[model samples]
Target chain A: MGLSIPVGMAEVKASKTADDSLSALGLGSCIGVCVYDPRARVAGLAHVMLPDSAVIRATDRVVEGKFADTAVPALVQRVESLGARRADLRAAIAGGAQVFSFATSSPALAIGSRNAEAVVAALKTAGIPLLAQDCGGTVGRTVTLDVASGLVRVRVVGGEPVDLYRLG
Target chain B: MRDAGRPGATGSLSGDAGTGTRGILFMAFEAEGITELQLDALREVGNIGAGHAATALADLLGEEIDITVPTAGLRRTEEIAASPEAAEAMVVGVLFIVEGDAGGVIVYVFSEADARFLSDRLMGLEPGTTQQIDEMGCSMLGEVGNILSGSFVTALAEFTHLDFGLSPPNVAVDTLATILSEITVTAEALGELSLELDTHFVQQSGQLEGRFYYLMDRDSLGAILGALGMAG
Candidate 1:
């Protein structure tokens, strides 16, 4: 049986062993990035909460996994350290949902969409192939990346689990 | 001005006393510095707000409602996400930002069952018959959330004399973790620290129960304290 490692809010985890799974649960507006290298059987997941770390004041403690701009790079580096080459990395993302819609113009209200855009942009800048994504909806999702198969599965509340994307 | 030692004057001069008590409340987190006085003050705020909300709900439903005393505390953004109360439970949430002098997010949480029950009541249908909330149901739930949260905000505004502008309520149905994640996003944007005030609601017959969370940013909390004449 493979061990399942749970990633909490604003957290990132990567696994090299084929017998492990990285999971991020209860993703609302936050985006979960899953990166995998099929040949090396290495996988990484980041629960990103915000779009840009630059908006954060210097006095505020920066959590690398908490923002899309920072988390994508951090995930790439972590996977690379586990022997997965950046050139071989493929990415799949889930979440980034506007769970609640408000009329206000607060940037925070639209953070989910902003996080999604940031993740995609970061992946492109890193030269990682964007394989599949299940994002931008009104529902919540939980994503799991199976290292052995590189299958990214997404489960929505009150809905059946679906294989959102995969990397060969 | 009356002397501080005078019996009637002490009540009027209790602002300093309240500040001293709040200081202990903050210190209590470090050690067991929370005093009965602090708890009482917090409970009083809860009682007043919850009382008003209960009245609003009862008026809307034409039924009697009851509320438990509220509990308030300071928690990290991650801690609230990992809390057992937010683990995998299906819930309906109404979230909004409190702008103006105090900035924060107010969230109203209802279990799937409770949401269904409340929706049925709002539609004047027989209770426990509806399994899901349709569009109309969602609208009703949103309005209820608005009224409940609005009542609480009004009570706090009157008590603290602070101008609090509230954004329109946005309602969503999802797992507790998912709903909490949204709140955590707001907390992350504001600050790592969140002031969490939680309360429970029960209908007169005890058939329905709901949980409400009021999340305030650290700056908002300081403003509230300042308005209350309590040291930040």
Candidate 2:
């Protein structure tokens, strides 16, 4: 079974009675960040939709999954609550594509580029080591992380296929 | 139920003015066979739902948003596909399943870019998160469409005095060809007389998109128009 959170939403690492665990589904300009603490046998997933939340005005609510500013903190808090130690966590990120077919533009500030950068910064700040990542292409992806087996399956519409274990 | 004596009238009390017309009216980005009044009613209904959706996004983003429903008229799917706007924009579509023997399908299409914006914001994560655009995206989009369609469904049930249930909305994200192809399939079974409307949501970038279509059989269209007193 899989737990699918909307973009900008976070789910802390947990192991339930159910043997199979997975986090599935994500969409445009959104990134799914997965963290696994092998020591704790816990895995967490955060689906981010934007670069930062502070940029959002005080009245809007639809961008919960789009920003790094909001997503990182929320994720940290969730995983921490699950009794996962900060020192042992490792991360893998996927999705974040410039899906539009427009002429080549600067990638420096594009939302996709920015989101990946922000996620990396957040990981560094938290002192988490980078484990793996498959990002920054035009195609969309559905990443399924299986906590029981530590397998991350990446699927795309039209792109080179990758085995689930490749990301781990 | 109102004025059952009217020879052409169906006994249902739901009154929709300016609704009936057997012929199809074509335009860019939308097509359907329901009465004009039904289309109008549907647009108003979309306004309400878009407001709710915008609110959901605004709340998550911590900002204020406004979603407006524009004036709509009948049009063809090809016309909508050919429109320059359709080429570069993200389209958000919601299909409505209404209750009653005469009830049929209703469709809503929006700009593709606007759809990306909506998805980016609605999911409340990163703007450029999912580049794959696969079934998961469809499910995410379906959730988005559900909100807008829910509003229309609520309005229809109340105004038509009929109990209509909405099947989970099937959401699709794609380019002009994808949008046109899907609409073509739906139109074949539903018939065509698409009435179009524009809906603008006020937010960070002031997202705007067009919404339209009301699908129904001949008698249903006439009854709705006659009820609304818009029949000419």
Candidate 3:
């Protein structure tokens, strides 16, 4: 049996051992970014809640893993610290769902799509290649990344687990 | 079979006096300085609203429904998400956005078993047998949410004398954590502290036990307090 580590809301975790798996559960509008280096058998996951931390004025206490812009870099650093090379890093993403659809005019309702865009942009800035992503639907998802095979699986309510991405 | 507890009996009110000077544009009010009296006032508002909602639900299901006194307070979005009561439970959430004078969101959460019970009861199907909610079941559940939410809003409006408009209810069946994460995301985006009101519901048949959470933004909270003569 593999060791399962849970990544809570606005949390990030990285593991280098092949028998370790990182999991983020109950992701609705929040996006989970997974980066893995197959060469080093290291995987990192961040559960990001918002698109941009810069837009928030609560500078006194900022959670880096909670925003797309800061979460991507922070996740990269975590993986790198575990002996994973940035040059060998590839990423896959999940979540970013609109669980409720009412009041389309409200800026908050569009946050799912905005978070996805922000994550893509941040990954580009970090020079990481995007391998695959499953996002933008009405259902919430729980995601797990297996460090042994670099396979990311997403599970939804009343649905079978689907293999969303694999890092080569 | 879980014993239900009254809301206000579980937690106490604590105030933070240092949040007065943050002065961020959208971060107007922090969860600080809320007095016990103010909490009691909010609790009264929730009690009245829950009474009305329970009455509506009882009428719809043709059963005796009981509701506990509501607990109201200021809490961080993360705290609500991390609560053990909601962590892994499978629930059906009915979410609505309230606009106008006091804007916020209201979420009615029912456990999967309870949701199916309500839907099955409404559809005249035998209880404890139907496992899945089809399209018709979904529509029935949505209507239940509409009635309960409308009644709750009406009672609050009457008590506070504040004009309020509600968007149509959006229903989603998922884990409680997922539903809560959506609320947390919206709350963080607005840079607003959440005014969390929680209520517990029970039915005579004992087939359903549900929880409802009402979250309001800072502006809306201020408006409500101002209307009740509790604003600083």
Superposed on all Cα atoms, the candidates' RMSDs to the truth, in angstroms, are 6.8, 18.5, 7.6
Flag clash pairs in model 1.
none
TM-score of chain B of each: 0.78, 0.58, 0.81
lDDT of 1 by residue, A50-98 (tens): 8888876776667898888899999999999999999899999999998
Query: Tens digits of per-residue lDDT for model 2 on B84-166?
Result: 33433445555554445335455556565555665676677587664555566556656655665565555555554555555
Model 2: residues with Cα > 4 Å off, grouped in runs: A1-18, A59-65, A102-109, A158-161, A164-168, B1-232
Considering the two chains of model 2, state its CAPRI-style docking category. Answer: incorrect
How far residue A164's Cα lies from its native spot in candidate 1, in Å, is 2.7
Q: Against the true structure, candidate 1 has what lDDT?
A: 0.75
Instruction: Score residue B104 of candidate 1 by CA lDDT.
Output: 78
| Best candidate according to lDDT | 3
lDDT of each: 0.75, 0.50, 0.76
How many angstroms is residue B197 displaced in model 1 relative to the true structure, after the best TM-score fit? 1.4
lDDT of 3 by residue, A37-102 (tens): 999989999999888887756534577888899999999999999999999999999988888775
True contacts kept of each: 0.81, 0.00, 0.73
